[model samples]
Target chain A: MSAPSSSSLSIRDLHASIGDKPILKGLTLDIPKGEVHAIMGKNGAGKSTLAKIMAGHPDYTVTSGDVLLDGESILGIEPDVRARLGLFLAFQYPMEIPGVTIANFIRAALQARLPEGEELEATDYYAKLYSKMDALSVPRNFTSRSVNEGFSGGEKKRCEILQMAMLEPSYAVLDETDSGLDIDALKIVSAGVNALRGPNIGMLVITHYQRLLDYIVPDKVHVMSEGRIIHSGDKDLALKLEAEGYDWVEKEYSAGKSAV
Target chain B: MTTETKPDIDIDRSVGDFRYEMDYAFDAGIGLNEATIDYISDVKGDPDWVREFRKEGYRKFLEKPMPTHWATKDLENIVFENIRYYLSQGQVPKRTWDEVPDDIKKTFERLGIPEQERKFLAGVEAQFDSEAAYSNIKAAVGEQGVIFVGSTEGLKEHPEIFKKWFGKVIPSGDNKFSALNSAVFSGGSFIYVPPGVKVKHPLQAYFRINAQNFGQFERTLIIADEGAELTYMEGCTAPKFETATLHSAVVELVAMKGAKIQYITVQNWSSNVFNLVTKRGIAHEDAEVKWIDCNIGSRLTMKYPGVVMKGKGARGEVVSIALAGDGQHQDTGAKMIHAADNTTSNIISKSISLGSGRSTYRGMVHVPKHLKGCKNNTECDALLINSHSRTDTYPAISVRGQGNAVQHEASVSQISAEQIFYMQQRGLSEAAAMSLAVNGFVNDLVQQFPMEYSVELKRLIDLEMEGSVG
Candidate 1:
């Protein structure tokens, strides 16, 4: 349990829905330790839905699926339980929690991870938080400010990465982490994420464009359409997809479905 | 995504755990009339003129009609004939802690008043059902010519200072409850600070209601002389009762030229108590007055602390936080009256409605045409924890002067699902997440309170949030 094993995050036939309409139809993917996987899909391709379902979001019903963390299914547990079991999802649009300082928020998260009756040391917590914030270029005074309130796009992303650094989740799901960032912010955020890469962690980076793949250079590239992965290749395939476009993948998937 | 969805859960309605046997030395029989008023005045050994004042107040109380506009349905249930006007354990307020009676001393100890007084407070006054049990001021503070005593002693000992400003700020016939409190007011704080004296520590008073179906009316008057500064804090708590209990207090503060006065109240009445209080301050030239109020655990509370800037360059502020649990209504706000030039006022109010509770923010800010350079800013925000919980904001702002600037901003928002989900994703339980968000909502204003009070306020809110809404 101390180290992220091979295939730390494995998704087998994940079918989820929002209300009556199905979103993810038999979606499947996996990421092992010491590896980064990128999933590129167009709008309505259920990319964000997959990330949310894995985090046990209440709005999205997992009709039929098996999402495993180290070979144990986490389909029926609550969202907080999933988080405590070493799962983290970086939302595309982080929520604005008014009046809750960043320092208190992170402290509560870390405190929840501890065993019962074990108090979190305030001095050590602040020291670790300050060092991590320094690495992410966050200001020293941000610890007093409310969580994600009046924050810029880059600051929010960096704050997300800062949380990841603090929580030390076994698997990280970065859902469209590069949605609203400028190039400079993207680079800073990517470097922060790169610094967290190690054999103890697995990452699933879901995005709409191949541009984010250029900086964080995933070990595997996935192309998804209509709620399921239709193609998988090495990192060079991302460059190839950028050279071409998503139109070829949709056409090829339709043709393959007709043949089936 | 716009409206936050609250989980449906019934609130816990258990009353407070602190209770004592009904052991009253004397009890004025149930009802309000001339006989009752006369009996109270006779028992307290009131002078002739003050007895006449009580008769006048009773007439006004009879003439005034119930305030039907502000939560009339809850007001209808209060049966005046069934409520006992006064009750006392007959223990006179003593200067020494050891002289106070056993049960009353034990109650204060349970509330941690003596411990707090030793740690931080400059003076303390403990009031039982109808009279002060113990009132003492530190020797160092008393040596600085600080007059702190019960209103009875204030009127009896220092007639020159007490008679001049006693009923001037809040007249006996101001409101129905105020008139009632004036007619039968028993025990409250009376303080007079000499000129140029600044009391570093806060003076506190604790009021506890022990008997059932009793109404506690305390009159508090604080006067800060020219260039003087003072801070006063009062806390109220009551034991649970089957019948309704009424707590109506009248507090008047007068800040003279260049003086400053800060008044803070933390009220946690039982769920069966009706808390209707009238608190107002008058600020003279270049003076400042601030009111920090927090209300929790009451059935119906209708209180609006107000300030009147009557002289040039005066400033006033009101920071309030109200928590309405199940079967409760917290209708609280502030009123600012700018009567002179260069007067300023600021109000920040935050309220939370949990379970079937309802909260309302009713504020009024007025600047006359003759005034110039008057400024006011008001921010009222409400958070609803359950779908059944409700909130309303009525801001009546009138700006007639050309140079006056008045800003009023209000928002009614529930705890969003996204925010809770985000917090839960960080490994916080649903209850913990809700409480954190709520404490954060009032954190800014809570910080303005004294350190001891701020911590206690947070803890009180945390306890109130437990089993409030799922």
Candidate 2:
């Protein structure tokens, strides 16, 4: 187990399954620091599976894999350990945690990253939370509502971004964040994600459509087919896929596979 | 009050490391017999009618079979011959803490009764074993014509009011335990608020059991006159003992026209105790009665605090939370009887069963055919924390009137693995996650508690949930 050349998020030859069915077969990807990359694929292309496995979801069994965060293996660690080690996943559909307020949910996440016995400063926490909520256009009273309970799709997405901002993770994987958003919501969410792009963090934005890439433009775009990345190119590759559709990529990638 | 001191008390004879056999001025000995009833009546110096009442109650206790159908069969283990009907500190209640007996005062101190009274309560009563050792009401509240004292004093001094309401709401023959309590009922709080006089703070009573195989039967009666408002809270805890203890109490409340009464109880008995308590209230025209109860730690607890709407436009509510830990059974719920027109009642019960524990919700709501515009709602939710934990719901709701409406909802849920993993991903350990989930399951009902008590309840629940799951 050697480190990847770049000190960023990297998944090496990952093979994962849910029960007896394999989802990700030898999936390999890398996103170096200071850059955002996108994985555009059709449904069942192992897009959400990649994000869940990266976050150490309990349902999935990773038979052979090495997930490295800053050049250290995170293969056998628990989900919380991986989370505290700075891995964040913005769920395609956020969980509705009844009776847990939004403020407490985010507070617990941040509190978990703190040293044991260290109390969270209420004033500082509220201050940071209010600022982030304002940036994301979430109402102040949203703090009292149960997490995602009775929330509209847009509000739920914005809440996911609000958490990512508050946690300030080293790497984040936004899984289909644009699925349930309209044009206005998409732009607002894109802007929030764009505001979080910086030099020290790496991000992998997974989406089925290239429309999301129009706003949160990635430095590089990869086309995934059948649980593995088939081709990698610059940002224009997303536009090419969006215009020509996935049929051309599937045909061309299968041809190349057969030729090999 | 008669002041008699017994010289035969031997405080050094320890029955076991955790159990004690304190020599009582009068210990009606173990058993329910004519002699025991006569002994108790003689000790209390009851009037002729009261003595006759006790004799009748003793007969009823023998006649009324154990509610083997509704109550758990464990009731058979409560040997009537093995339980001392009454064991007191053998001292009348004093008005001040300084005047209280040292041994009893130490117990109250350990339970934080004095500090809580000094901080937030309008009055405080401490009952040790079978008698009230200390009772006091704040001067300000007393000046406003509030009455807070032990039941004995209330009956002896204010018989005009006590005689009318006592045993009226819940008759002795209503249930087996109520009859048992009626026979040996000793020390409990008796509170009265005059018309149009509202107490600013809650009146609290703390009950502690010290002797093993000793039965603590406290009879409480609370009355709120017309246009009055008051809240009463009770807390109970007993030391751990190998021998089983019996705690059967009967509490009755009466709210006059347009009055309001809120009763709260947090019972944390030792696992060796069987707590079978009967509590009910009567709400008159436009009156309101609420019961907020939390049951945590008893080997078996069967309590269903009820409310009967006896007058039109009255309202009744019961918000209860029960937690059953290892080797515990909590069969508790609420009963609402809509006997009048245009009455409303609500019941919400939340229970948690952990580590092979069992929790059952047995509720009943009834509106007769003659009543009109009566509405009742009941919701019972149970959370099972372990694979082996058990929960059951038996809700009986009947609405016979054409204009009446009744709704009952019950649900049993287990902690979700996905939710636990989600919380774990947010940095909480599995145990911490489980604790948080359990707290959330009961958070809505707990929020109905007073802020201080709710905080304390959360802490207690957290301690119970530790190591509940691996």
Candidate 3:
């Protein structure tokens, strides 16, 4: 089934935790295809945890509620299987795998998406990899180098986006993709993401500041505080948060929830 | 040297009842005794002094007991009497390829030795059972005052040089296997590079075990004279067998002042073989020695190639990689002894364990208090492919001198599910992901080999990853 145009990702009353300590307490959100949704949160606001739980990370236990992709439950599927089903998570700190070249790493992921016993065409694989790398501004020689080993912060982030663009998942989540980028890298990565934006893929950008939103221009903004989203608005809300800061969101959410 | 009239003998038959066929012929009822030793000595027409040395080594072998304390206890199960220690197979080692017997030539052809030598090797020596069937060195390399030939021929031709350094580094009583090798060693490579000479290409030796229940003891000695440099590679394989075969060998290397020597070995024996070997080198003042060892297949292998830096400004290095698959235990490591001032050593060891396999790194790094400006770095990494696989590291580092600097780092990690998932999401299967992880783990060590060997090593790792997934 194709992804749902509206609300391709629907997280309802989600509760997650590591051991007895709850991280994402009753979090709820909706991200639709053909739209870019940004989640802005302060430190310890569970933004990273939310991204991990949606990717089916094994470390966090989803205590309650459901996470659906295109109206189908993906909470029980394996992480890789969930990824093959059109969901992607771009990690903030990518793992360094030595000896595994970038060419082999991306090829294996693309091969997993093919039919059983069908070998990937080497010529076509390199063609696509080279094209993606060119788009991300990654050097041609990087395909032969090991993945993320000894790479600078900007290079790792670009590598993550290169994989995302190659996989072409229905819904994508970028957690702190701009945390370590310079202004030039931020522009290049934003341009790459914008080039991939279309009706078939939905995007979720999670960041600690609104500076990244200035480059990617998110359509909607959600402010997360104390493990839950307490405010949702248009893109102007990010500019407002940037101007006023999280102290305003925290005070507003605590007072209103206590009064209710 | 008529090539057309030779009869077609099935070289596979020489391999006996082993599943993995060896390429050499076998003698009828060859055993280890004074008579057999005398028969060998007389067959080679050795001088009286050579024969007496063999007798003395034989007495030493009988007096020495097996090494039981350091490695696996299962080594005690090897029955020395059950092994046929002396087997020349009636074929004399020939310096020219045309002089080799037809059956032995066919065996080398089957093992792809000739082709390998033609492509990248500067010299090639094919040893079958207990003798070198064929040995050849490129003419240009030979013209440079470099001598590479079988040890037996070396003794016959250059007795003055061969006898002077023989048993000097690895004496007969150093260990039980070494004594056995000294007493009955038949065919191995003897290489010498004159002072100020540098060999561009690597020389290679391929040892094939052709008979069941037979022991192959090949003694190798490489001496790089002052200001000289050389690289040597050796590969060993035996036919699969129901009953186990024994392989006990001794290798000694001497690097004189301002000289360098690099020795590489890729051993893929059948699972029914006991591979117990003793290899060591000595580096004099301003000399360098390196050992690049790779162990792929064997039931149990206990080999620790060591180096003794005996002179000031000397250096030693060892890069070893081991893969232990089902029913295999790879016990391999390196030892570095700093005996003089300004000596340095670096060791990087990597291992992969699959199924019920086990890989252990038992190493030693020593710098005596008297040694000044000595530095040592040792890093060991092991990757477990499955739940039942196991890995262990036992590093003994002794820095007795205040002026010495030593750094030792070890890490044992399993193939993480998350890492595999990350790779699979990129379009790789579970098996491919695991293979990538393993290759990454050992990339640094594998890259130290020559280009062709490194490519072959990657393919071997891929083959090993098959059937390793749950």
Using DockQ as the measure, the top candidate is 1
* lDDT by residue (tens digit), candidate 3, B1-470: 11111222211222222333333344524457888778778766778877888888889989987777766777877877778876765677677767887767776777778888889999999998888888889999999989999988888888877888889988888877888888778889999999999999999999888778888888888999999999999988887777778888889999999999999998888777889899999999999999999998777898889999999999999899999887788999999999999999999999988777789998999998777899999999888877777788999999995878999999888877778766755545577778779888888788889887888778777767755664
Please write out the lDDT profile of model 1 over residues B97-200, one tens digit for every residue.
89998888888888898999999999999998899999999999999999999987888888799889987888988888898988888899999999999999
Q: Which consecutive 10 residues in model 2 chain B have the weakest lDDT in total?
A: B1-10
Maximum-TM-score candidate:
1
Question: Residue B333: error of model 3 in Å?
Answer: 2.5
Where in model 3 is the C-alpha error above 4 Å?
A: A1-87, A99-104, A107-146, A149-155, A166-171, A176-188, A204-214, A218-260, B1-32, B42-47, B94-107, B368-371, B386-389, B399-402
lDDT of 3 by residue, A1-260 (tens): 23333458988889989989999889888898888999998888999889888888778899898888988988976777888889988888888787888887887788778888999999988898899889889899998888988999999999999999888999999999998999999998888888889989889999988889988999889999868889989999999998888888889888998999
Order of candidate numbers by TM-score, starting with the best:
1, 2, 3
Candidate 2 residue lDDT tens string, B405-458 = 888888888887878877776667777777778888888988988887998788
Candidate 1 regions off by >4 Å? A1-7, A251-260, B1-16
Better of 1 and 3 by DockQ: 1
| Candidate closer to the true structure by DockQ (higher is better), 1 or 2 | 1
Residues A5-61 of candidate 1 have per-residue lDDT tens digits of 445798888888899999889977878877899999878888988888899888988
Models 1 onward score TM values of 0.95, 0.92, 0.80
- Specify the poorest-scoring 10-residue window by lDDT in model 1 chain B: B1-10
